[model samples]
Target: MSESNSAGMFSGRKSEGLVLVVDDEPDVRKVVRMTLEKSGYTVLEAEDGEKAIAEMKKDENSLLLSLIITDIRMPNMNGIDVINYYRKEWPSVPLIVLTGFPDMDMATSMLQHGIADYLVKPVEAEKLRSSVSKTLEKREVHGF
Candidate 1:
């Protein structure tokens, strides 16, 4: 890991890029925030996809969203629709989808559509950080 990444992982939250955590479950949101914040990312919470969209829109500098971790199944809107809208509106925001489903075909389709990464439910802290860091690196390379 680079020095910056090491600092992010261990030195505790010096960096301040906003990360949106979208899940219907309160516990998931709480844990995700705790994990990412501990790793140096500022986290924002939204219960469902609709609220997530609203939060993104309410902020003027939506491009600063370092990452969006969204669950696939939600009440008002789903992850797929959220992905579609983000692609249309805020393409700069890197998305990491979380889902309970393990269908390879659906995962393949989501990958093709522009998600930075995907995670299965009950994400480990290391796995989540790894994906977040990987996506951030991709953003740096792609000129986000």
Candidate 2:
């Protein structure tokens, strides 16, 4: 695989820290990774929540992840589980949820669990960038 296609690896803007993106779809991961990388952030990707957790555990000893962006549904594990685990294990790391299914109940539940932001599927590049920037800035200001 080319350097760009490597999962759990980063290229460009090392100074910006790392963001973990968990999505079951490879296309979604590619688009999100490219968008963030262009905005001067390094990105790591996992195919599902289980792999995301594994990646987090592996990187915990090395990289200081700045954020997590995850899809709501996936095989093996889902975003809610990922969020819950992170909330307890890595409370300071911010999370953003992206879901094709925008249920009011689900959104409300995720918000109550401390998700930084939520975006529906087919997210525009600019909107994603804005959400990520705002979320990171909020965390910085709050001393997370």
Candidate 3:
């Protein structure tokens, strides 16, 4: 086999998904899209919870929505609001929070309110991949 084939070469096409990634930072969104796409996930984006919800509502294909990655502090509806909304509307959407500051109180509150997991800002690709994989594999996007 050629050297490229030895690595289990990746497919250029991303997984057919409509994942909602919410964050105020454009750079953060770029990184996430790049990472998730590399892992074969088609990513959807939102600058805040409101936009996220809007995107979710526009979702066709009844996409499984594999997961949602959001930032805790954002304008015009923070991650908390997004989590709360999904809890009622699309109860099956898994949420992972990314924050510049990861406080126990906030984490506890989110967990109590149904957040699947969290990550401190500057989230590494590996961490994102692992968290996403675990969440999707368990197919427990609704439990949180």
Stronger candidate by TM-score (1 vs 3):
1
* Reference-based lDDT, residue 26, model 3: 80
Q: How far out, in Å, is residue 125 in model 1?
A: 0.6
Best by lDDT: 2
For each of the candidates, the C-alpha root-mean-square deviation to the true structure, in angstroms, is 6.0, 3.0, 6.9
Tens-place lDDT per residue, model 1, 52-140, is 77876664436557788888786555557768866776677888888887778878889988888878877799999889988888888
TM-score of 3: 0.77
Q: Can you give the TM-score per candidate against the true fold?
A: 0.81, 0.83, 0.77
lDDT of 2 by residue, 74-104 (tens): 6554557768766776778888998897678
Count of clashing pairs, candidate 3: 1
lDDT of each: 0.75, 0.78, 0.70
Per-residue lDDT value at 127 in model 3? 92
For candidate 3, the 10 contiguous residues with the lowest summed lDDT are 1-10
Residue ranges of candidate 2 with Cα displaced over 4 Å: 1-14, 59-63, 76-79
Report the alpha-carbon TM-score of model 1 versus the true structure.
Answer: 0.81
lDDT of 3 at 35: 84
Name the weakest run of 10 consecutive residues (lDDT summed) in model 2: 1-10
After the best TM-score superposition of candidate 2, give how far the Cα of residue 92 lies from its true spot, in angstroms: 1.5
